[model samples]
Target: MNISTIGIIGAGNLGTKIGLQAAISGYQVNMYDVNDKILARSLKSMEKLLVHLTRTQQLTGDEGKQSLERIFFTEYLNLALQDVDLISESVIEDLEIKTKVWQEIGEIAPAHTIFTTNTSYLLPSQFAEISGRPEKFCAFHFHDVFYSKVVDIMPHPGTSSEVITILEKLGRKLKQVPILVKKEHSGYIFNTLLIAWIDAAGRLVTGEIAEVEAIDKSWMINFGMTAGPFGILDNVGLDTAWHITSTKRNPASRAFAALLKSYLDQGKLGVKSGEGFYTYPKPSYKDPDFLK
Candidate 1:
């Protein structure tokens, strides 16, 4: 369909990052969100990020300006998607919400337009059921903070090779390392490995086998310290991690569920709220509560 205009249905962190990158790559980008405030906030954040990239010489001033100019943010779903060649849905993680959004996109988007989701847990086959045009839909997963780079391209049984070709090409244009996988597994490759690791850590934390810092230190120091489990948990947000783990209702995940519930009950929501597993004091440090 000679894809050019890209439409993103969510304007959160991942959406903002990917939309900005696509726009910077010279593709027309349209972002849609139900909340006007969220859309505005995302736009402001994107501007700030582009300015930083320009100042650091990662992007030329002219390039940054062009990128910012290329992106258009709106609250109307139909308008944002009208002429889009590709639609990427990054809406709430709930399956019901995704199903409705995909169904609407299928009805509104151009017939040739391809639809993709950034869901981490739900299988593409399940999402495809809602898209109606399953042959033209797939899962285009992106890593948080990594933008278009390091994406997992998963196609459902119904998705055609042509759609995958276009998506992979677009991913490359956006500087993403796109890997095509055949199965419709939940969590795909990264999260599958990550969830297993996290489950193990959860077991230790709940059992009080070691203090939080001790456990964190052992892994960070032993595994090169790029990102400790606590740091990741914090970054992912205690509430988010809790929900992800709670979906399966496993005994190993119960501790995290309880911990997050307790924290939320106390109104501590991590870095956004200036606290979580750690305290945010200029240079934040782990909170003792995590250890206890």
Candidate 2:
């Protein structure tokens, strides 16, 4: 299928990035959220990203301007789905919420539109049937689109082979490296390793084995990485990390979830809210003295 226009069914961080990238790739984009406030935030985020792209020479000023011009932000589901060739759902990572959103999209989206989910850990089969078009649904999960450029094309048992091929092409169009997950697996590949690493970081903190900076410093200096597990969790959003971690049945996961909950209670949602394990725009992990 030739995809011309893309519909983004959520306007959160990842959704905003996807929508912006789609527009940059010369696809008309409709970004949908539940409220005007959320839509406004999504637009603002795109604008900020465009500025960074332009400043870094990744996108010319005119290209950035044109990308924004190609994007339409809306609160109405029907408006966003109207004439869209594909729908990428990036709603909250909750089964019930995702099912509910998919059902609504299945009701209103164009019959020919392909359906995909950007779920972090959830399987596509969990919502494929709920979407009312099992064969048309698959998981097209993207990590950080610009930095982490891998997109996972994971199909449920009912997904069509044609849809898989189309998504592979589309992923490359969006300048991503597409990897096909042969089977249904929670957390895909990178995230599977990531979760174990993050779990260890959480255990160290909650078990009082080490402090957050100490844990992060140990990993960053050892691996020559820009950010450690805690630093990454902050960028991923503490709430999102908490949501994923809270699902694990292990004692260490539960303890980490509780710690995340405390941060959430304080209204500190990591970089988005300007504070998490450390302050943002100047996180200590980014400091030269941090590893020292």
Candidate 3:
């Protein structure tokens, strides 16, 4: 089915980014969350970002205004689901919470609304049965900054070929480079590679092989890359990094986890909180001479 209106079932980092991009790309975006305060903050943040983009000449003033107008935020599930052709669920990553969110969407959303999840670890298969339309269920995962513009479309054995085709086209409409995942994989291609690389970088720091700045400078200069692992982690958010690394506790892993925990405890949860492995809005990595 052709998707024009999108129902985003969470207003957190990933969902807000997706909604913002969808709106900017001219889709009618309904972004829903259970918390009114959080939804307000997200909308406010989106507005700020639009003005920033306009100021930077990345978006025309009229275009940014229209994009903001296209997004509708709500706490009511039914309101968000109304007339939506596709529902992208971005609830908490816990299996139970996701299953509950999908189940509710399955019950209330339009029958024609195809379901997708932005889950990082859980498989689409795990939530398919609860979705009430297993054949129409798949993974439509986007990066933290949807403006990076790459999306992973993963279909399980039970998903209909038709659903996958619809999503691939929808991804393009959202201005994303859609990558079809041929099999069921936990992290898809981009995430699996990214998580490993970041984890290894953390290990280097925890093992005392290098300071965070030194390691970042080395990686950027050697690879001629824009951002290094710590900077990337800041964008990914420290809470997520801590959660991903918490399961391991070897000497190196323990040290890394503790460092992340300290940041989390202090509410310095990365780019969102203005601090992490580095401070943001102008981290040292962004300095022109840092790589030198």
Candidate 4:
């Protein structure tokens, strides 16, 4: 299918990035959220991102303006789905919430519109039947679109070959390297590796093995990495890490989830909330002397 118009279901962080990238790629985008405030925030985020992209010379001033013009924000689901060639759901990672959102989209979205989920760890098969179009459904997971350019194309047993082909082409058009996950593995590839690394960091903190900064410095100095697990978790949103970590039954994961929950309760959701493992806009890791 020639995807021209894309509907983004969820105007949160990742969803907003996806919609903006689609618009920049010359695809008309409809970004949807249940709350008006969230929709408004998403637009502001896009505007800020455009400024950065323009200043960095990644996009021309006129191109950034055109990209914003191509995006339409709406709170109404049906309106967003109207005439859209594809729907990418980036709703909360909860199965129940995602299932409910997919069910609604399945009912209202055009029959020809392809359904894709931006779920991080969840499998596409979990919602395929609920969407009422198993063959047309797949997981089109993305990392940080601008920085981390890989897009994972994961399809369930029922997904069609044609859908996979279309997504591969679409991923490239969006300027993302496409990776195929042959089976339904939770957390896909990078994330699976990330979880283990994060679990270790969390253990060090929760177990009082080391301070957050020490752990981060250890990884950064040795690996030449800019950020460590805790720093990365901050960018991922402490609440999101809690959600994913809470699902694990292991003792270490449970303890880590509890630590994350404490941060969430304090309203520290990482970069978006202005604080997490460290304060942002000028996080400690960014300090020139951090490693020293």
**Model 4 agreement with the true structure over 87-147: per-residue lDDT tens digits:** 9999988899999999999999999999999998789999999999999999999998998
Query: Per-residue CA lDDT of candidate 2, range 42-67, in tens?
Result: 99998899899999999999999999
By TM-score, is 1 or 4 better? 1
Q: Please name the candidate that would achieve the greatest lDDT relative to the true structure.
A: 4
**What lDDT would candidate 1 get against the real structure?**
0.82
State candidate 2's TM-score. Answer: 0.87
Indicate whether candidate 2 or candidate 3 has the larger TM-score: 2
- Each candidate structure's TM-score, on Cα atoms with residue i matched to residue i, is 0.90, 0.87, 0.87, 0.88
- Estimate the lDDT of model 2: 0.94
| RMSD, candidate 3, Å | 2.6
* Residue-pair clashes per candidate: 0, 0, 0, 0
Instruction: Name the TM-score of candidate 4.
Output: 0.88
Q: How are the candidates ranked when ordered by lDDT, highest leading?
A: 4, 2, 3, 1
The model with the greatest TM-score is: 1
Residues forming the 10-long window of minimal summed lDDT in candidate 2: 241-250
Angstrom error at residue 67, model 2: 2.2
Question: What tens-digit string does per-residue lDDT give for candidate 1 at 1-292?
Answer: 5889999999998889888888988999999999899999998988899888888888998898888898888999889998899988889888889888888888888888888998888878887867778898899988854433588899988999999898889888888888887878888888888778877877888888876667676786676654567666766777777777776666767776786778777777777777777767531324434323
lDDT of 4 at 292: 88
Error of 3 at 2 (Å): 2.7
Put down candidate 3 lDDT per residue, 110-133, tens digits, no spaces.
889899999888999998998899
Q: Which regions of candidate 4 are displaced past 4 Å?
A: 206-211, 261-284
Clashes of 4: 0
Model 3 compared with the native: what TM-score? Answer: 0.87
